[model samples]
Target chain A: MTSGDESRPVTEEELHAHADGLLPDGRRAAVEQYLAAHPEEAARVEGWMRITASLHDTFDEVLDEPVPARLSGLRPPSRLWPRLAAAAALLLAGLAGWWLRGALPGGDAYREAMLPHRAAVAHAVYSPEVRHPVEVGSDQEAHLVAWLSKRLGTTLRVPRLGPLGYDLLGGRLLPGDRGPVAQFMYADPAGKRLTLYVARAESGETGTAFRFSQEGAVGVFYWVDRSMGYALSAELPRAELLRVADAVYAQIEKVPG
Target chain B: MSDRDRIVELIPRLRRYARALSGGRGEADDLVQDTLARAFDKLHLWRPERDLRVWLFSVMHNLHVDQGRARRARPEVPMGGEALLAPASGGPGDVLERQRLIRALEWLPAPQKQVLLLVALEQLSYDEVARALGIPVGTVMSRLSRARATLRALLAGDGRAPTLEVVR
Candidate 1:
């Protein structure tokens, strides 16, 4: 039988079972008696009780907080770009026979600017891998750094992911608008994958801004620091992505330019 | 009432449930906001006859699970900045006790924490929790039993199991 069957130190499952109030009367009574005998364990249970109490104290009040105006019946502002795009789509439908070359002046540049979008799509496709998730494992950090840096013509640092319960699975080089870009993949024990796409910043000042963009089920968080532009794409919730992005930002900040 | 109005009405309960589930005020508010956004977006799918609060809660639970998975992907730098640890006191200590409690909740896996909060704090019926968690009623009971027993042990500071059966 497994160690779980023996039940030496408390298993997380058992802890959960107890907290869930699922134990049989006999087992529950045994646990309670055991706790009564063990003061330390009883204190921990009390702590849990207090936490539940505190949670109620803290948030039950929010029930009375008025819902924000923006959330209730407020419509998000309609940006100009989408309207222009809709108009263009309508116009394009009428001129089906004619090849409208250069219909928009920055059309090519716009397509090129959307490299992060394409990369986001690719990231959503490949990040869910179990075995062959990354082309280079973080074990070869030095090599991975040298290769990606030389290829992208910018210094690259592989962020440490120990705190997030993930280590670098490694990275791979992928094609981009300028040339090859590096995709670093990280995975947690639960097999959730997050991809960090690093490429040379497009011509402009590196803006430190948080921008949210989405396509299909995937979300892309793209930002530029110095001459390097980073895009983190995943199918995870937006808040979680922001947390990962914060970690990536912290690690990237520590690297000397 | 419009679905949006109904959802707006549920926000307070949603915040309370989220706070209980996360074991912290900040994270709980974040969870509630996410749940509200999702519920609003998927309002068409909500059946009017069904309980809106429970439906919002399930969304919040799923969001928490998704967030947990994502956090696992990118580890952050450890903030070891020392805060004062609580002194041994019989009654509820200070803010430190609350912090310790939060940390302990974090130690439990997501499912267990969710189950415990739903039943114990939210006072959700076993049937309500089972439906919210998409698990069987029997599974809900077992999970609640295990969670309560574990919390009892953790709080009691004894590694031994609890002797009291929690009658719902």
Candidate 2:
């Protein structure tokens, strides 16, 4: 038996297993007997242990380095508001909270570069739900818009995509790398999803070139307005998604305050 | 913790493992991104009693295996490409010892190198490694032993593992 108490002649596997501290009590004792008798084999097994220790030293730093936002699909729900407050304070002081941005180069470059990808990741993560998809369903559209607007510190509008074959499916409050963000979900007649990602743009941020990034399976059309960034993401073709984004941008632009 | 929280916590270890398998940071992160996508897509397959960490590791492992099969029949990416050459942490000190150890690892057959890392770096038991890789525990032990022997030979300048290309 693999865990037998009988000190059957130890195999080489048992010796290394001894080095790994992986042997069971019975086999561990037997291997201890073998290693006690054979000094050379004991020394080699010790080397394995040392190698294993140094491997941790070499790689564990990755654990502390911030995970990139591109990989973070959603920040935990409880962490949203506090980070939003901190992000707003940093924004007022003309600093964009570089500490929260991870190792993605410097300043607004991280946001400018990562916005679309983050949106696409969020879309891929949440847009597929048959249940519990939105925190506030469309039945409560006024409350949803007001709550999200309060959290995001801006006026909000849900674009009417009726002409474009998609209808409002409500929205959720999410934690962005820098602050609280909002996602407005829409669905076509066949239940295909499109999400609009909204976050506060840094002060002094200029209007963008209207970038389109294909993040894995999702296509994202994203841009910066005067004080907000927007990314409309979906599995739709580029032209189709662009048309929808243009309509959304136009409606959002109509919000006066 | 929520499954989402646990998943977020495990990203770094997944990246470190990806770095071992595929060397470039871009490639490693891409691998991790892909892994996260797959894990979320297959989240329904996971049982509540199973180890999420191990299950996620297997998701990454199987995803790579499937992607590997698609790209020209290669067993895996060419090892020792670039991640190992960079210092694993802090400033690049002597790094000679670390380099030697990594070089030895790069020389190992992909299977052995994988088993070795799963054991040494991730601290997985043979049984867990077997479960993650879909192999028997006996096979995990044999590959690990072979990996040890090969590492011993390469580190001693014997150049024994045919799979490793000696950079010197």
Candidate 3:
């Protein structure tokens, strides 16, 4: 939101276009100056450039795969893609999710508070979504854990709360503070949903005190264990949620994080 | 070459897009199959001056949208997200990052993903992407920006959350 106004030196769209190579050459110098002055914006632009390059690296060779006979001679060809998408050789992926907050003015505490807010936001956004609730389902718990664990660069265990009458629904990777976060969802028999959000604990802060934040009707109990942060969110009585949070904390505590 | 003949040659290109679009080989081929069927059926409606490749993509795009609508109507079986398997290929270089990119692209919303794939993968300019997707150039830029930010978020920290649906 910083430079959204067209009157600014460089607007958000200009940064996107510049990173995307869509910005005209005439405007490139000013953007370079803008990015030079803004380290965060530069990091974001670098991250986008990396994404564009990786996309080329991954699918550019798709044209080389053998075409199935079923698709042959049936319809016209999309033919050759005109260009090979060269020119954006990038080095680092860079830190992300600040762009999620977008040029908003926030201090360290506000940035750290994004953990609970994101957890609650993800819960509210996905909890009511019936058809596409999670990226992976509990039926494929092993794969789900492996995928999410690898992405988050940590060993993760989905808390088993079946005895507590809430079954694990699944989990999804979400954009959040510092890096990607994981949300493991659960649902009771009556279809009431609960979400537990996890992210890597900010370095230099471990075993932080347990904190509760009420985001609208959703109550979130968040705490930072060694190297990992957890937030359990649900729309229930605080005592009831506290019970589940304690259970989740205790269960995950056994895993050595 | 005849338009039909040209389409036959471009089937592989369409298949490539279908794979990125659908994420499942079987489902993607099914989409390409349907696109071919529709292309042949509506061959007469195509204008001679328009770029046939772009026109054919529009055909496939329409089919994808319709299939999405049909999938939404049948809510009995929720989408299981089983379609999101990162295709295992490529040399040792950039294997993980590349896989993450594919998975990230699959995870993006359809509108944003389409704009990005058309512009990045297909080398279509903003105007060309708009023409192919039947959206304005400004709309194309906006979608591309959203898609870029999402990819940046996903790629930066290896977050690849994907979504999918099918009538079956």
Candidate 4:
């Protein structure tokens, strides 16, 4: 071996190799000899050794403590689309009941009857432009698509909404009752914003449905398609909101087969 | 208990590995929990013949990588510098040392860190680590060498010899 090899001192790689139990017998012996001569290095290595021991001590107890009941309990195997359909059915029934009670007029009547206005309340609480606005951005559209597709097991096209004077801002992958959902954002020229949250249904069925409500001045619209759901919300006028909904539907419909 | 239950039992071990890899940040717990939840949700995909702990580790590893990629794609928002440097509380000097070990761990490159953790902390064989990381055994060996050398340098302070006692 060259002098360079001899004086090189046991490298971090070799120490890691030694730590990992990967060094060959001969090299390991050499390293041991080097360490014998080098007290400071020995202490450092010993520190890491202690660190491993400490980690086991600190967290290993979690194993013996009973696993959380919710985690351990048997959960009924759920079909993705069917559960989604059941939820939608319950929601529609609730909406129909409310509509009958009020006897309101037109699609606006149905819109007012069933939308999740609380989501708008949540949106306003979390949506100021700054850090942590959305988990994923439009620049990584490819990754977002792949991830959401894998989770939902369906090809999700990022709907184009240029005609509504809105451009794709970004999207986030969120957990839902069925699986993961993709939430896409669009912004108009004046900086007004809207979000399209999409997820696969637990069942396969198609129908035109609408739910609407007002929360702190924000109008919310939600709908369901065959094996999918969409929610749209903003502070825009009801008519303008419907126009945006139409644009969202048209673009989503054009998602390539 | 079924295979899924057995897999669930391995969560704590997976969490320990994740904590070592992540410098004992609570983020590691989240990583392990997410892995377990995903594995449970997709239990059908797991093959029965494989080791459950190894499979869980693989899931944790992938989730860590995906999260890392997502973090990198976003603009870096600076957290306070002191928060980055403060040692994790709890335990004794040993705990502090462990935190140091993990911080030193962050100094190594990602590939070396992965190889070192799998082999050293998890005590996987070189072959097992290679399979877990989808790298060759030789690459695992070399990477471990580099990782240990770097750790020794960092810990021992500037190219000093390392004191290692062979376990008889």
Candidate 5:
């Protein structure tokens, strides 16, 4: 083994490179020697290798799953005519949507109507997480509120839920159709979790009345309060979820001006 | 094969990366669709001299960032629990251990997760991950180390607080 640097102890970074098999030929032998002299370090390095091995075993199968058709559906760039046609169709859809807005029941209500659907979707997306239910845990409630407020361009608050037996789990920032969204998660002692998705309401979108929607086992309570749209979604029965929603609304509505 | 055919062949790898990135199959499909569509639309903008795979991944990464900015959040979907837990051949202990690993992975911060996935999962070189993420190679190295350490701590039950098991 070529030992160019026999006197120097191997660094942690070099050991990591050794574990990942990225070490140069000269350094590889030195690292092997270092590990040989240290059985405990060898065990730790073995664990890292196991982590990578397990990760590969677990997810490498995904590479074999057939690519979904929709992802590969678009015609190649050589098909200029079809691409132009598709672009034109998208334009027409935009025009049609704009024209239908006036004909539809109050335009703002239609937007409001979609918020609960989004809430339900987001709930379906996040509620079953075995871990990582929130971006900022309750320990950083103050920081979460401040960060989300800056992102959404509105002062945000985390509603207290102690009385309802649900404690703040944390909150995560999400992409909304228009702008940023803030979703706060809470869970009861039994591990049943609920989420509150909040986003800035579009200008002229106004409503205080709570609307409800149910999807599968999930129920959503959504409403617009001036410039904010709030959706509370959980797997509880309608009445029980509504009670929690009412409490959430009351706590948030009292956010100091 | 033509460049278009080359891209088609790369779809499965892209899908795999998207699956790991998004954490949910449906959301992964959406990301792939959006990425492929955007790549096709912007095909002319691609320089032929560039590595097409890296360019495509950069496109996907940028698109993901755009989507995140517009929506202001990473994907919120939980992986389907039943599918993961039902590994058929693995023992219950192995299944739980795998589940714990998945959970720990999900808890990683996005930047570290991105670097770790690119380097470890996709087997990309540090330079390639840096180019794809538009970060320095040094940053990639640091993030990879931190991610591995964090996952180690989490799996060893040292980093996270222990919770009482809820009895049904």
Candidate 6:
């Protein structure tokens, strides 16, 4: 609502704000002048004011009414549930100590194992989309790559998959455990989409070995290369996905490494 | 601090709000008890980053909506329990008008009544009302305007909903 110029009349929004005492003094004065010139609108505004005043008068006393004992005595009974759950977990761990040791992946092994599953989950969430498949489209691939590289603090590249019968569909930035992850999407001739999720390696460690993991229908091929960890996730069978993963690996490895 | 203590502090204000919404002290106390129980059970869903008051109001509003739906399904259930009794110390005329005001408030659509009460009674800012109701600021402005208009018309007794018989 305009309150700047005399020519810019006060609008309905301004009037409502004034009625509610939400407008600044300057704007409130402008609205008052407008209402003065308009008697019917002024009358309506006065009615609204009266309504608020009456409402306040009618119910303000409830605030001072002695709160019922039932309400004051109410407390969440589940406050200790978290502590109990934690205790149970510790007990289970202690009971199965010998069997669990070396059986469960922890530390670096846990990170290496979970990375692909995260990529697969991201794929499951974004794939099969009719619209908004990527935050930035492939037409602005150069800008997308530069923006992501800047955010992740790394020189990132979008690998071309033209020979693999999939076209680059651009990328989006996503939250990762350690830092930001840059995910690039590609669509095949059949319209099936795959994603390449890249993020900084934990502790700057590098692992060139390509490992596979799957969740539901999605399969992921992830590896840590130099300062970055990369995961290529798709819903295709393992054999078909392996071929695409190899191509992606080769293309990414050749980026001035 | 635990959610229990945080919620306990808000009980007075919550009771006040329930009193206004339910239109009777007994019903309002019942509503408040239900709301507190629901809030406690759903405490895990609350995020520390969000405003606790607004979240509690949202839970209470949802519970009220569910109760309204169930009430509507059973129209045979008699409505209007004990009339919202304002003390007669304000004089007979003032008492009747106050009773009329409370009755008019109950007759207003739940959405408008909510916006009006949050702003007029609770003095919540437009943004806070929007967050509590999960509506946009623009909607808040419009709904509030409509609510106040309906309230004014009803109080003026311009022939809308049936007038509740004021008990002596």
- In terms of lDDT, the poorest run of 10 residues in model 6 chain A is A77-86
Q: Which stretches of candidate 1 lie over 4 Å from their true place?
A: A1-55, A58-257, B23-27, B67-93, B159-168
Position A206, candidate 6: lDDT: 73
Where's the lowest-lDDT run of ten residues in candidate 1 chain B?
B74-83
- Against the native chain B, each candidate's TM-score is 0.74, 0.78, 0.78, 0.74, 0.78, 0.75
- Model 4: TM-score, first chain: 0.50
Instruction: Decide which is better by DockQ, 1 or 4.
Output: 1
**Scoring model 6 with DockQ, what do you get?**
0.31
For model 3, name the residue pairs that clash.
Answer: A75-B7, A75-B8, A76-B7, A76-B8, A77-B6, A77-B7, A77-B10, A77-B11, A78-B10
Q: Please compute DockQ, using alpha carbons, for every candidate against the native two-chain complex.
A: 0.21, 0.24, 0.32, 0.18, 0.29, 0.31
- For B38-146, candidate 4 gives per-residue lDDT tens digits of 7766778778776666677777777878788313332121233224434456554455655555555665566777776777667787877877777788898787666
lDDT of 2 by residue, A76-107 (tens): 43133433443344343222333454534554
In model 2 chain A, where is the ten-residue run with the lowest total lDDT? Answer: A90-99
Predicted model with the maximum TM-score: 2
Assess the local accuracy of residue A196 in candidate 4 as a C-alpha lDDT between 0 and 100.
74
TM agreement with the true structure for every prediction:
0.40, 0.53, 0.47, 0.42, 0.51, 0.49
Q: Candidate 1 on A1-257: residue-level lDDT in tens?
A: 13342334444344434544655453565566567778877665665555566556544565677655323422211123333444355334323312344334345445333545655755754564433567777888899989989999888888877797766889999887768889998877655677889887777747558677665466778788886788888778999888888888888988877
For model 5 chain A, where is the 10-residue window of minimal lDDT? Answer: A77-86
After TM-score superposition, what is the CA distance of residue B46 in candidate 5 from its true location, in Å? 2.8
- Give the C-alpha miss distance for residue B85 in model 1, angstroms: 9.2
Worst-scoring 10-residue span by lDDT in model 4 chain A? A70-79
Order of candidate numbers by TM-score, starting with the best: 2, 5, 6, 3, 4, 1
Predicted candidate 2 versus true structure: per-residue lDDT over B1-168, tens digit per residue: 778778888898998887766655787788888888777667779987888878987888887778772232232324543343333443323367566665656556667767888898888888889988889988998888787765655554432333434221
Clashes of 2: 0
**Model 6, native contacts kept:** 0.64
Which docking category, incorrect, acceptable, medium or high, applies to candidate 3? acceptable
